[model samples]
Target: MTENPGFLLTVLAFVLVIGPLVFVHELGHYIAGRIFGVKAETFSIGFGGTIAGWHDKRGTHWKLGWLPLGGYVRFAGDMGAASQPTAEWLALPPEERAKTFQAKPLWQRSIIVAAGAIVNFLFAILILGSFAYLEGVPRTPPVIAMVAEGSAADRAGMKEGDRILSISGRSIGDFEDIYRIVRFSPIEPMQIAIDRGGNRLSVDVTPGVLVERDRFGNEYRMGQLGIGKPPAVYDDIGLLEAPLVGAERTWGIVRLMVDTLGQVVTGRRSVKELGGPLKIAQVSGEAAMMGWESLIGFIALVSINLGFINLLPVPMLDGGHLFFYAIEAIRRKPVPVEAQEWAYRGGFALLVSLMLLVTFNDLTSFGLWQKLGGLIG
Candidate 1:
């Protein structure tokens, strides 16, 4: 199993990673809808071509689709396809259109739609925070964990367990500080002061440029000082602290996502680097191979992506719907149905196009496209 080829590994990875994360996301919306009395017609685990399905007492159809990329919830009178009314719904007079989604208050409708993405972010934070608190964060204490063989750090005589006291006379705190210095440091000679063998020593090493990928697929060269991180000493806290830490971490990730988007919009980053489902599956399989902890970590990471994606100000998405609500709140009436239709059409096209591009990139990155090219060549 460990030696399995890439295609099988990628498929299994997609199932494990995308499947549960998406289910949890849709679950958020489904539960919120039920709580708020907005009848859901179907809760599906994928898009297009249902593989299996069952109906519930609440008149909701649960389904597993043949395609495993993504899922959706069909609400009663959802203003689009994917739903059908039961006899009871049809039996109701025109005057009693209460159970329809359109009948719900704008605020309630917004929350129900937004819950899926919100829950995804919350899930990420909670999971990461729990992991952090449980095992303690891996802290590279101004100290080297492991020096990579023949790397810059190893060549500079940086040994495992050697605590870096300073860099160019600036005192160091934790591993992050070292990373900051190393990642952004100019490719020039720099002095590093370390406490090795209980004695302080200073050595000069030149930072080297290494290529790395950002969350977006853009590659950039950055300064590198190769060193691994050691496990932090676990310091337990009250139950309340865990959630707080989780929330802060979640917010930070959200901020990072927002910043990345800004960079893309500002032309400081490449939009083509944006990854879609295929890339996620590849990452998931890679993470899974590392360990359960790594897989769970990837889940937390993707949860953040799910949350942010839903918040896009495009119609048919949670954020897009919210944007309409905002306009309604300002104008004191719903946006014209025609306007919404146009917006949704545009958004759907943009989303679909983006998906196609990312899928292509994913295949290309996995060498699938390259292999096909080779066969033809």
Candidate 2:
């Protein structure tokens, strides 16, 4: 069958977006390994059967593969890119063993493993900083624009043009700060400090609970104070100040992610919101079509999430490796190879399952499967 134009665009966009980001990620690991005197046997940009490969002066086999999904860097004496230990590697001579990743001191090995995520985070911060520097940083004051009629804000005596000074005993500097508080305090009655008609007054506003659905039908149960935004004002930040704002913005995104994850765990949020590669491809393609600025912002977001996700303690990931290293640090020795192998196996399986589930959701969201089913019927 002939490929669809839209499908081609998505595939191209996915590769363009994910390929360089992943390369940057693996490069972080590779650079760290080289710095610590570990010999990189292979520095691959993708997986599956290799399309073309060549050896560098240092004997690191650099290759591109058929799949543009992900990349890896295999160090000498390591079994593969994930840096799993091998029996043969363990049996190497002392000099050779010294060059293996497993042979490094705890701190060095830990740093090497954590470097990828750190780089991702830094990349995001830099991108965000650049965006803020180019476009003025938003400095929206906490002034009410419109309150939903008969909504929680209306019932609490909130009015148009009222400025929110604080919520739940915490002061608010930006409009987003107020939403941050109400979004998390789903069940609590908020003690709102408002500036109304040039007089400071306190009011109790209990946020209402509502279920919001995304385009993919992913549902979110959130606390809404029913306050809308006024016209935004931008603050022209200095070059030095932009990075600080970017860092703060990155932290805010991280906090929001953590809150969402917590809500998911507590059954207050639906797992449908959890997406995978296909969702990323769709979003990336859409963002790219919007504009370079939007695409860059989306890529920055993905980078942050990529870094955070890899830090998860599940096996077969950077975080998983660091977790084992933590155990080794405490025990004064590495975790047994056999135990690690099993853990990695389980982790890989779980990761695959999640990928499949999310891919299915993506297909469903795109209505591709339904169309295919129609043809079959």
Candidate 3:
């Protein structure tokens, strides 16, 4: 309720964060449909009972809903934006059927379905690129300032004044990259290339366990190389080069996310790291508290995440729709309607299961169960 400050902040942050992303995604679909000559019937920002709405010049019902969880856009002949043709859709006169989504050619349909995710990725690129243009690219050179005595770096023959060039074959852009990699990889040893004066040498270092405390008085274990970087410096970024730098930055996140998913599939990563709405809301609230710049950066990261996740070729996703289109293209005809229904059903179930898992993970992250146990014990 609104009386509970923390609770209200979380809810508000969740709505604020999810609202724009979903609006942008649906806008992509809506715009693409208009470009391709499909009539959009309704553009709603949420589900269930409508709170406020009006008809537009284009004969589209634009409305806000009471539920703030998710949103959709329904075209003239779409059962929904998923664009599956239904019996009602089929019952339309031949003249009316011309405006239906299924009437569009395969290529157009594919583009429309994929537009939401593509726009999300583009949003991230623009956000990051703009930051780069204004603030410049971080070029900290990864030089070590001091190595903790008898710590992981010291034990691995690392010395002070060493300039790190790369880790595990990946070039280190900044000191933060080193921290992220080290923190994520606990068991793996890092093969690092360094520049010592004029000599280029390599070293292998296993990260040591470092217990840390957060503002919440919560304890966490992160990997420690026991090495610190020198003062920060940034590269001179031009307006033209800013977007390219941003794309490169976005690509890095995409690669990391993909690799993380691969690790999960291979059982090398814990599924508990998966975050749903609750985790997102918490992060959003934290970012909001931090300041506007932090919140903007968080939004950019989430946009990239939304794009990447939607592009995964899973059922009940944008990628899933595209997957069926690919099959249809190859088969020279649509997959049977019965088969599609079954596939969508399966996809919905998969999504629901993932939602439940991530919600449980969020609860655990919040220490809800632990607090309850403490109460009971």
For candidate 3, what's the RMSD?
A: 3.3
Clashing pairs in 1: none
Clash pairs of candidate 2?
A: none
Per-model TM-score, in order, reads: 0.74, 0.85, 0.88
Q: Using alpha carbons, what is the TM-score of model 3?
A: 0.88
lDDT of 1 at 114: 90
lDDT of each: 0.77, 0.83, 0.83
**Candidate 2, 1-377: lDDT as tens digits:** 32233777778778878988898889889989989999898989989999999998988899998998889888776675345667788789999888888777889888888999888888889999988888887779999999999889999989999999987666789887887768765665769999998999999988898787754344556789888998788878789987887887788778778877876788866677678898898777767766788788998899889888899999989999999989989999778877887899999999999898888877877788899999999
Best by TM-score: 3
Q: Candidate 3 residues 1-377, lDDT tens each?
A: 11222777778877888889888888888999989988888999988899999999989999998887778887787674245677898889987788777889999989988998888888889999999998887777688999999988998898888988898899887886787678866655779999999799999988888777755344556778888888888888888998898898888889878767876888876898788988898877777776778788898899999888888888778898899889999999887777877888888899999999999999998889999999999
Better-scoring candidate (TM-score), 2 or 3:
3
Off by over 4 Å in 2: 1-5, 80-87, 90-93, 160-171, 178-224, 372-377
Prediction 1 TM-score vs. true: 0.74
The per-residue C-alpha lDDT of model 2 at residue 135 equals: 85
Off by over 4 Å in 1: 1-5, 81-96, 138-209, 212-234, 368-377
Model 1, 185-287: lDDT tens digits are: 5364679999998998988887677997644343566778778878755456566677777786677567657756765787655666677886787677667
**What stretches of model 3 exceed 4 Å from their correct place?**
1-5, 80-84, 90-95, 161-163, 173-176, 194-204, 217-221, 374-377
